[model samples]
Target: MAGETAPLGPARVCRLPPPGGAEERVTELCTALLSGFQRYEQRIRARQYMDGLLRTQGRKSIANIATTLGAPGDEHRLRHFVSRSHWAVETVRQALTAFLEESGPASAWVALPVSIPKGGEHTVGVSRHLSPDRSRVVNGQRALGVWYASERVVAPVSWRLELSDDPPTAGRSTGGGPAQEGVPAPQDCLRELLDDVRRWGTPGPPVLMDGRGEDESGRLAALFAGQVPAAARINGWTPLAGGHRTVHGRQAVAALDALSPTLRTHRRGRDGSPDRRPVATATATVRLAGTGNRSRQENRRLTLLGVWHEARREPGELWLTNMDESAADSLLSSARLLHAVGDGWRTRGAAVGLRDYEGRSLHGWHRHMTLASGAYVMSAISSSSDQARSSGRSP
Candidate 1:
């Protein structure tokens, strides 16, 4: 299969072991996983998760897993491990970290819809009594838009933003108390995502995300040094000067109010322009309804309402992140990757990857899954590499 041809993404199917030594591919996958070990803790978690999943549940367990990487006959073991609430949380965190490390260095744009279920009464890590699945309350399930970027390589990068928490159980409700704010704080989530990529031990490309990353509009002020940066629909708003509706920034209030309605859901590459189409955006300038003031407000609340016309593909669906404004092509590339990864998820029987199975209470299922999945991705890469090499061509 070394010299044979194969496409990329879903259209491409990798061959089996090549006639050449399989050592090189194994080395590459291992090295890749190791290089990002510290940056992406999921690698470690995945290995462990797999170990537990592949273990003989009853009595064939090893003395101390930490002491043995992969025990003898472990491959034949098969009694899946479960995850606890805390372990599930950490496992999700680790998976996100790994995603950043593996693709952040080479990607200039990435976006994913993150679900931040309001902790009214059913949140696991919070003291709320809310359950989105209850069907009694209106406007349930809040999601913080997410984005990741690194302007370094050309690999197709994607982010699968999924919720790690459990849904509200029957006959339970969480309507009182403060909402359990999303991870890393609303304002810092975006920057924090970038920080995770930074730990990859490699210089990353320019990263861009949605408003969730830069929660308050004021955060956008600290761009790549004065270049009013736009990341597709990261902030979920178009371009406004004095911040958007009720946003606490320095744009315009009228500029902000007019945002929601005027925002375009989608736009084509050649938007009726002679030379590669004019960059048209779903823009508006208005005063937010809630906030009365709209002048040179210092940290005044405004709304960041924007639907990037540039990266809009599916009609009625808004591109809610910075990618819409910044990396149009990269956004497209990521969308495609997401579609391919979707298949893998169904095949593997889970929406989130490199995660452990969650059981009630405080089980350590997540660590086990992360360990297994991390090892799995590595193994898959190696397998593909071997198949390519076997066909007589370098992968």
Candidate 2:
């Protein structure tokens, strides 16, 4: 059936919170979006158009947000804000501080991972080799995000997105057919992400992330390699890498040629049969191939810092973690918290993976990133609630 043509609809009038309330909600939502998840800009903008002009587009677009917010009655200015915005990061930070007022005063252990989406050729932060796909020709800016997981939490503590660039390639170009080189590395973007997290400063549990260059056994490791109880995914050998094991939502499987010599007991099935002992936990770093002079020995000091408490693996995905079954499994068994942070943008507002819906041109495409780390942070809160409710711990 062919779709019918429609005229400009009447201005939407949504059930928006009053002025003070609206601001508060906006701040609250934005803060949760920023500190709690990556893709703050997309989220913040989506919230803004929940009521008015944007609503006319659909429930998923910025226009929908305007309708949700009761149209704000300021079409001209509001439209402009929605079209071009970049204040999401700062706004989210402000909201977090305001929220921490009550949740503060407790030790907080944090874990964050920055995911680099693989696609595109002319992306500002695109690089070669760092991508798992091994696409000599990369696409889009490299995405490095941070996920925060509090000590007492099981789900994500929060999320952050960092668009980073890498050294340029010599034999790769569009029109010229693979013959361009001499750009720069994306070390700056990595530096900025670290600096931002440090400024956020936590007085509680030590901060943690996957083994980053700065995360050595030093005083400034964002994620302390020494303690605070953490279970991370590992690569090649790191001693802590064990046979297929899982920690709550985190799963660690074997990697191609990255498996280590470690034995572990696993549950093959419901029957109490002991699955052949898999390797023990292991962790190590590798200098991923890039288009630069950063040699393997110079930047690659792979080591097993500590044992991870979870096995972070995806289905049919190979993963290695520096964790033993006894240690990593223990944390996984006790886990019961989870949350997520994601951001998506579409020129035509269609679902990201879909073939076509609406874009000015035929080849229009949208980019959406959903980061999942600190999945433990949210699960922890859920566990606590269920336990409290079940045990009649209510006040």
Q: Compared with the true structure, what per-residue lDDT tens digits does model 2 show for residues 1-395?
A: 00011111111211112223333544554456456324555454434432232224332333333445665454444443432332333334434433332344223222333323333333333333343223234433333343333332222222232223333332221221111134322333334444444556454333333332221222122222223333332332222212242121112223312433443323321122345322223322322222133342224322232222233332211122223334433433222111111111112112222111111110111111221121122222334455555677541
In order, the Cα lDDT scores of the candidates are 0.33, 0.30
Which portions of model 2 show Cα errors greater than 4 Å? 1-59, 68-76, 82-88, 97-101, 104-142, 151-190, 210-232, 237-395
Worst 10-residue stretch by lDDT in candidate 2? 1-10
As a whole number from 0 to 100, the lDDT of residue 48 in candidate 1 is 54
Q: List model 1 lDDT by residue over 1-395, tens digit each.
A: 11011111241223223233345544544444444344344444434543443332322123233234445443222222222212233334434445435533344433232332332333223222223223232323332222232322111122222223443231121221112343333334344434444443243444443332323343343222122223332222323333322432223212333444434324444323445633333333332222123343323222233323233321111232222333444444443333333334333313223222222212222233334344444444455565565678776
